[model samples]
Target chain A: MPTTTRQWLLNGHPRGRGIEIDNDFRLVEAELPDPGQGEMLLKTHYLGFDPAQKGWMENIADYVAPMNIGDVMRGSGIAEVVASNGGRFAVGDMVFGTTGWTEYLVTDGKELTRVETELSPTAVLSVLGTTGLTAYCGLFKVGKPVAGDTVLVSGAAGATGSIVGQLAKIAGCRVVGIAGGKDKCDWLVREAGYDAAIDYKAGGVKEQIRELCPRGVDVIYDNVGGKILNDMLACIATGARVVICGGISRYETGSLPAGPENYFNLVFRRGTMAGFIVLDWASEFPGIRKRLEGFVKGGSLKYQEDIQHGFENAPQTLQRLFTGQNRGKQMLKL
Target chain B: MPTTTRQWLLNGHPRGRGIEIDNDFRLVEAELPDPGQGEMLLKTHYLGFDPAQKGWMENIADYVAPMNIGDVMRGSGIAEVVASNGGRFAVGDMVFGTTGWTEYLVTDGKELTRVETELSPTAVLSVLGTTGLTAYCGLFKVGKPVAGDTVLVSGAAGATGSIVGQLAKIAGCRVVGIAGGKDKCDWLVREAGYDAAIDYKAGGVKEQIRELCPRGVDVIYDNVGGKILNDMLACIATGARVVICGGISRYETGSLPAGPENYFNLVFRRGTMAGFIVLDWASEFPGIRKRLEGFVKGGSLKYQEDIQHGFENAPQTLQRLFTGQNRGKQMLKL
Candidate 1:
């Protein structure tokens, strides 16, 4: 029934590392189009913020297409089918997909997946969503933690890192998290079930990791790259598996950051470093969600969301991820 | 038999990179000890110079023990058994093992391997010894080059790199080699059977690799690390496998050198980087040697050895590996 909608359009490519509100994006009022046959109109309930979005904003394409000037910012979100002409979705049905940075969208229903209404919006957007699936697949498939293995996670206080720590603990590994501050580190150890947490803000990250994991880390799930990744590489155990989940540290940089200087340690340690995208495992997401849901119901896995209000704050909320200002899975409620 | 034997002793850990004979080694004359029970006395014939020997000289212990200040310089060589109390060997038997930079050694024969007398010592040391096995397992097991894959090798004119390119070619992959100069690059394509070669000394190494492997490198066998490793990381294909065989570039540095800067590209390409040592595959060396020998015998695999004469030139011959002076497998005839 709405005649107009609001969108945050990409106004320009970032000139440097930081994304500027005024320069990089523009708030616009757009005419709302009606859904044609086989299509449905979605009202975005919440927008998801991820470090990977910064890469999407670059001129080069990665797992997904790059964001271009004059385009609605590319993103994922929890949305509701407000108007439907598609057989796959009905009005009031909740859905999740690449909903972009918009208050509303008309889709052919092919890209969207119907989400469960029983769960709250936070759960749908965080724990039972792509965030949870990434933690599950990356930790299990790539990190491949064995029971009693010492698993180190960078960005330990963030949404995916939190779930990864919990899931690693559930899998019977000793979990250590590296977070930016005392508060986040405390949350990691107390709330997220990490055996230990390193406050990178306090410095001596390498010595701290060495003190805690004296025998060396067996599995590393890295979300923060740059010096953090380098530190982890320095102390990995023989035959260690390093899962390159995300490199939040370098996402906003004009160029890819310097790599782990000790990566040559892989030869000395006879280890493996691998990288993957969650979208690559889309076909098996249903199964991954079911497994994670079981962990949630059993109280073994816990997740948190840091939600902001207003559609206009979308770009600012995304900046929170880079600055480490947001506590958990960053989201914006429109 | 001479009562006195000459040995090169490690005088000191080099204060900086680049081995110096006068500063780091001392030539000493010592009494030749007789073989005891379960032991054999061997006279060195051919000493094999390897990039890995430089790692053994470092203060830290790697796959093998570090060279102590008073210890004879560690090396691998072809030797002939002159005396034996061990049941495993008899007098005049040709054997190969870690003979060190000494004219004679008494060993229990456990570390030694019996080599074929039909093949020349160069073939035994360069194509059938640990060098060849490194190429075999690293290429087939770690690199996993499937038919039609683009295989790129650094140090492509060296002993291991030459064999790696030939092996990759035999495996039905498109082989591109990156070597130091025009002569080395020409030898790689002409003699070693590489599809193409890039002269890294000409500069624009990255541009050359991009031009050669336009679809991107799928299997990268890196013996030389540093900026060259960083270059290859930039243009890897999706699902590429990087086999970290050696880091010759960082061997003599007082500290480990900086690693590949574009390693984050692994995430974008969904690739794998693995490192390994050949000694770990000792159990399978026989099987691997048989495979490599088949290639050599079938005239499909070619190898070249850069042999230097005189025991006094041992340190200088080893230096050839670092300076890009040795044309193929660097060796010294004692």
Candidate 2:
């Protein structure tokens, strides 16, 4: 029998207390198994580290199932097919799916999507995967940006916002970004084609947003809710639209973040604020995927990866997202 | 010179707290002015009494200008053009516009819309006016209810909600109404064709809503925003839409209403909460007016008027609204 490595499990739920890297997880070993009917055995290569994974560790129920105690940490990963019992893929075929944090995973062939070598495997797990699709659907379908509209994006240099800013520019909108640091702000304006970038840590968000968007913002792609969203609400123009894609700011707070106090601005300005999840537009994936891929191939869109070196770093890498430490899409390499 | 009784200025601004209804206004005898090259002299008949008028009374910056302290209170009134100097109307033709609370007035005829008596003068101020148009725009344009979708309407016995509930039912939706009392709830079921009714004052709004909408609410037309809006958020189905038409509960609080705490539910269920103002769809009024008139004429849509006897009672009558003392559309008889 060929030798195999076993997976590790995160031991307990992280609720009120902040995540402690040392006490939260444990490692274990198990026997290797043969591929069953229509199943494939996968060797994990690149693991995706997202802020949502922290949510999985916490007790609060979000859009998906919560991670259970003693379960392999839930995540998406790029893998190589080692043993296949299906016609869809063979040994050496590359695929991606929710394989959790592990060295090897056995899943039904239908669960994995076959990827082409033309695109980088890491890119498929980052920009061309769920994160990219989420930005596309939330902006176009819900935000509905028109040409010449002023678009304000929170978490502007993060995985989703970087792509969102580029896409808005391509759609002929004037984009303004809100990021945490000077470096991210500089990158957003210099590399991502943002018209203006605001460093949220410096304060005066409402004043800076007012000065940047004198006519007021027409579309706000909000990733970090709480105070930033409240400030955005005050700066929205007549008939504006606010798209709530994520609320990363409140993820670590012991209590729910206070909601926008000036929500009545929606009533007077005749604006709209809506929240959405990416899975709702799963039916439109093929078309959006082709367009996003074309943008990447043509160099109109840029995908950045903050790749962590090993599997053991997954927990620490996810912590980087909450601290605003990662530059772009955070990924783990094994 | 023919004598005319007019309510005009006694000074420039009101003194101390509360609306000074008694000593602040004065009745004077004046000569009726001749119409200018393109103006008309109007004789008043009925005036619209709205809570929005109270907003105009307060000295605050809003979408429209506030009523000056000593000036005739700004109001919407039905008037007859006693003398005309243009092609728009002849002597004794009926018209409607922002005519003040007075027996006689003169205007350029430009802002006055001719009232077609084929539709009652009262209908011009009720269903064919701003109240009806607000309900029409919100229900069709924002809520976008489909056949068989369940719609929950707050303040379902008020001027707008009463019409909104019937309209939703006419559009083939199962309607549930929320009112302040059992009598109002009965009125919504018996007169407005609502499938179920909940008296919010009696409590258990969340439980009652769940019982009424087993499949969950597809759309909610919220007027009284506060705990009711918060409670309604819990009952929304996948892809539900919450239309914020007005927030009467928060109006008196002098601050924005606390937004629903479970707003993250928008992402969990893939739903949307959008705030709207009627003026955004002003261009569609003629089309909506024609359809709504048909309903009123055919007896499919019935409106109840909570008529206050005289203009002198306007302030006291306005108090009826906040206390839930009035039944339907509150209007003042001149």
Candidate 3:
């Protein structure tokens, strides 16, 4: 029988902060797309929420283009193949890629990479997926942490940040985390194995980091950019390496926000700030994934996923991320 | 017989623009001290006036220390060894190092590097000394231009920029130059062999760059930093390398000014902005000098020196650089 698919389409641009973006998306019903030759029908299982999605909603020119009006809000998720006309995949096989915000999608299996892990699908897609790779390549390739180096990670309790802090620790460096609220701070220290945690909500983030890492930061993996980045730029040691992993703090803005005002600190300290995307190092993933998965299973590294159920609440669910309501990797179980 | 030496001493900090520094220096007479064991007395021949001298006068915490009040202002120039107790440097042999601004000075011969080249003194310091080393090592090590790549240099007709542009040409890359005046622009295109030259004084630097290098700038050797750097930041191609060789634009300001407002473009383009000091690569310099000298003698590369006779006019001489009165390498003959 032919089926009906429910999806959220971007109808308007976000205007205000927090849940303001809730009104930008509308839920609608569409007919299920059938698989043709060399194609497969994917049934959505889980949607991983990322700050980059906000960039797509704003229609701003950046690393990636903005999502146009009436388009299914772009997102990456884990899904099952319910029907297939493709030779590579059989029915009941699960694949991961940009499945969008929909219950069902028909693709030629062009972009999808088959999920081949025995662990829970959310665990693989959350930590072992793009989130893990982003932090892994960004820290190792760009930041280049050496033994006894002082590493700082902003948004340290979040999905990617949490993984980055642990990876830096495994490299035999002191890991300091900057996160908002007390719960996140506690988790970074108690669960994620950070050397120290700074509560930005309590203010004095710069002072705390200074007190903790008196020798000065050797590398920085910045997810949140703004005054926080400006303050940290001043405290780097000579020949420091700063990796621009993401700038979630300014993603909601209409125009690209001004860069950190104190970037000359790079000159003062003779440092290097390198911006990169994980896909640039995608070819080395098989080795990296095996390493990250070992850390996850060995209990040396810990990750958190904030999962919610129900596809109807997609808009408000995304709002949870911006409002600081999300505890970890924000995800929706459909 | 003991001789009296004339030198400029740092008397005050500069507070305003355009020769305000005239008051910052005071002419003083001091007895020429005799060289001790393993020491030599140097007779100053040419004092190289560079923008970094402004930083030395300000007494700020940077790569080098600030000149103290009533102390001989720190500078690097070419000098002839008049008397020597050290065997490494012989009497009448020319040497290069930080000889400061003086008619004659005595040194322990510790910092002086022997000048073995047969070229004229000003030519060696102008194109083959630290100025040339600053451009050569900076462009190759940090900027890392590849063949057929598009390279842009600011301060185009000036000492460092002229060498950098020609080096890019030698590397088989397309080179563009940005200079402040039409004459400088003509020299860059006609004399220095740049693919194109933009008169930044006429404005629209970003547009001109975009139009000339449709493929986008692969590497930028930036000598001036300010809005000019901000504009160039916007035109960099993906994975571009930006070498922060100098920031002459804001050197005279009282405070360290804001960084490029468009620096986030580094993240968008997945590029690198690296800061380096020429001394860091001093080991590779003997080889770099031979290569640069060959290009100069072969007629493929050219350099310019705006030489003013007299050490008494050193204060106003530096003003020529700030006010754009000097056409090329600003040099003061003792």
Candidate 4:
């Protein structure tokens, strides 16, 4: 008997408009093959959709290789190992790794990390996964927020920003968040314990930032780097730190964003601005994962999943991120 | 009889023109008064002529207060104590501080550091003073170069840049210097022990930087922050540090000098760009000064001073720095 599977592929490179979804992906049935030596055949349950995926689809070379034409879209997914070839794991084992967007996958058993079924499978792909890890590394390692420091997090309602704001609050730092809508802003302050939230869509961001952060921002966790980053530069305190994790605002433009106009303030205030990549701190992942796992289990750190049904909806879910339609962690249900 | 002493005062504020020597300052003989309680009379020996003094005379506020019209021009100077009332020092003690532009003056005992005459007297105002401390703090503390790292310094033959290049060499780094003239470039490579020197006066800075630092720049100590700082950004390796100690090029411009056209390089390379003020590191000075004094006494570090004659030439010597006429520290002999 043949098994049926559905998969998503990069149909075409996105220009200024957005990524295009087309006939590149196919739903087909194939004969189930026995596991080869050291290979595992897995069933996909949940797929992680992220803005970083859009960055990968653009074919621009960065820290990682871009998705090639007609290749299965690269993503993080939670899966069940239906069959195993060797002693690393037995049948019915759950795992996660850099798997493609598909209903089923065959891996060489190299990068697969076995997951404990007692833990929420979704949490492994969200808070206990790359999203939480990126937030941890950027905030603790790069941002280096001290107790009583004032932290400003841009993209505050998003997955990484939400986690960063909560982490800052736990560290006893006053946290201010910047998001797009009133609902998101409210959620940041009310649910995430952010001291305040600025709606970037409401206008007067620079002035509002100055007003909200009277002591001036000690740490700025930047994900959307354009006018927001430029304005934040003006409100930085002495010895402030600007952490660059992403530049989503200028990503589709396919060119470098305009440099911050008030960077000279760095000299006057004795401040620093640095960029970070989460993979660089992979050695410290176990520590972060343990802490984040505890928070998630204790309900101290909450994550919202904006899941789209069906693997076919992966492209549209990614569009929600750029369009600001998704509330939290945008994911695609397999 | 009252003693007559010559003093230079800020007569008028200069506009767009290079500080007009005639209209900007006026020399007059003033009656000397006895040192009051908690006050001391200082006989100025060498007045430090710095480019910052030009901005001080512009009628605009900077990091420090602007020079008031008719007030003595603000500066640091090596002085001999003629009389003392407070018990901090004796009559023959040598001191350095913001002693202003005058042959003799009375000041409160605050803001003065007694210089040990056993060490080189000129060094108390040059290498062991603000200029050398600025270089040391900006490089070792901010730039944070590691052994075998490739360090690039802009304004490489200036007082601070020259010392920074030598220090990077001492720390086991391959030092590349960027200066204006072939003579200055040769001095940087031969005398300062820089591994290579790029004459920024000649064209092709970007290309030359790429060729010289094929492995890419690990640290860039920037004093000149116009085109040279921009060029250094392209050649920076991953995790490089850029220290912004000063921006001499933008000091006198009517508008801000155009910032680096490629600052987005910071994001792609996962690097850091920071600016520092020397005063913030004031607490660390005692340790830095002790080590620097040993280097100077052992003849491992050499310093040069372009000592111009007469206090009347202070305004002109300040202008020479902008025109790149003086070789090292520009000072006026009282």
Candidate whose lDDT is highest: 1
> lDDT at B294 for candidate 2?
91
- How good is model 1 by TM-score? 0.98
Q: Per-residue lDDT for A1-334 in model 4, tens only?
A: 1154566666666655455555433333444566678877888888887777776777774678867777777888888888778736678888887877878877676777888634567877778888899889999999999999999999999988999999998888999999998999889988988999999999999999999999889999998887888899889998999998887786657555566756767887788999877888888877789999888778778887888888767766667888888877878787
Return the DockQ of model 1. Answer: 0.79
* Clashing pairs counted in every model: 0, 0, 0, 0
- Sorted into a CAPRI-style docking class, model 2 comes out as medium
Candidate 2 local lDDT, A1-334, one digit each (tens) = 2346567688877776567777777776756677778877888998887766766787476568767888888888898888878736889988887888889877786767877636787877778888899889999999999999999999999999999999999899999999998999999999998999999999999999999999999999989888898999899898899898888876767345557766667777778888787877877876888899899898889979999988777778878888888888999898
Q: How far is candidate 4 from the true structure (C-alpha RMSD, Å)?
A: 3.3
Model 2 lDDT per residue over B36-77, tens place: 788877887777766555456654526676567567777777
Poorest 10 consecutive residues by lDDT, candidate 2 chain A: A254-263
Best by DockQ: 1
Q: Write the per-residue lDDT of candidate 4 for residues B1-334, one digit (tens) a residue.
A: 2376888899987655567778889988988887788787888999886665766787653557667889988888988888888836678888887888888988785788888745768777778888889989999999999999999999899999999988888788999999998999999888887899999889899999999999999999988887788899988899999898777787656334456646667766789999987878778877888888888777667778988888777778788888888888888787
lDDT of 2 at B143: 92
Q: How does residue B144 of candidate 4 score in lDDT?
A: 98
From the highest TM-score down, the ranking of the candidates is: 1, 3, 2, 4
True contacts kept of each: 0.87, 0.57, 0.56, 0.58
> How would you class the docking of model 4?
acceptable
Candidate 2 lDDT: 0.81
Candidate 1 per-residue C-alpha lDDT over B59-177 given as tens digits, one digit per residue, 9 for 90 to 100: 66465676789899988898898888864888988888888999988888888888773457567788888788889999998999999999999999989999999999899999999
Task: List the pairs of residues colliding in candidate 4.
Answer: none
Model 1: per-residue lDDT, tens digit, A1-334?
8878998999877644678878889999999877888888888999998887777787664666767899999888988888888648889988887899999888887888888634575676788788898888889988899999999999999999999999999999999999988998888988899999999989999999999999999999999888999999989999999999887777667567667878988988999999988888989988887787788888888788899999989989999998889988999988
Please, what are the lDDT tens digits per residue for candidate 3 over residues B1-334? 3378998988886633433655788899999877888877888998888877776777664777656889887777889888887646899888888888788888876778788775666776778888888888889989999999999998877888998999999999999999988988988888889999999999989999889989878998888888888888889999999998777787656555556756677777889988887887778888988888888888887888899988898888887877778877888888
Tell me the spans in candidate 4 whose CA falls farther than 4 Å from its real position: A1-34, A58-62, A65-70, A117-119, B1-31, B51-71, B85-87, B90-93, B117-120, B254-264, B283-287
Per-residue lDDT, model 3, residue B113, is: 77
